[model samples]
Target: MHQLLSRTFKPTFLKIYNESHLHNQKLGRETHFRVVIVSHEFNTISPVKRERLVHKSLEHELQAGVHALSVIARAVDEPLDTHTSPPCQKPVV
Candidate 1:
């Protein structure tokens, strides 16, 4: 997942949190993630567009069993936030 985002965004700062454990998935599965990506590529883009770009870049992984992706996309000039993913509310089916 990191590799995919890196390739597409060329981010100056990137943090990926494997939050699958927060959800009711198999113990070791890499199914959910929170990605904080800071890149010059995001300059002038709206927040929604930045997220769409991240989603577009991860299309393959999304189709291949990545259950959820929470993206925090930022322009290089923007201040970083102490953002974290919220715990999953949906229970195991």
Candidate 2:
């Protein structure tokens, strides 16, 4: 996933936070992610378009096993948020 994003987005800053353990699941399982991407590629795009671009890059993982995914895609000059994320709604197994 990281490699894919790197190749596709060419972000100046990339952060992939694995939040799978915080969900309702067994320990050490990786199914959810919080990604912070800063890229010049996003400079001319809207927020929705940024999400679409990211989803397009990770389509197969979302279909295969990833239960929840959240992203903060920003342009190189944009500011990042420092607030906390809400609870995950992971599926019941």
The candidate that achieves the highest TM-score relative to the unseen native structure: 1
Could you say which candidate leads in lDDT? Answer: 1
Compose the digit string of candidate 1's lDDT tens values, residues 1-93. Answer: 789889888999999988999988889999999999999999999989999999999999999999899999999999989487777798659
Query: How well does candidate 2 score on lDDT at residue 93?
Result: 100
What digit string (tens of lDDT, one per residue) describes model 2 on residues 1-93? 999999999999898888887887688888988888999999999989998899889999999999878989999888987345688666779
lDDT of 1 at 40: 91
Worst 10-residue stretch by lDDT in candidate 2? Answer: 82-91
User: RMSD in angstroms, all models?
Assistant: 1.8, 2.7
lDDT of all predictions, in order shown? 0.91, 0.88
**Which runs in model 2 stand beyond 4 Å of their true positions?**
89-93
Per-residue error at 58 for model 2, in Å?
A: 0.3
Task: Compute each candidate's TM-score over C-alphas.
Answer: 0.91, 0.89
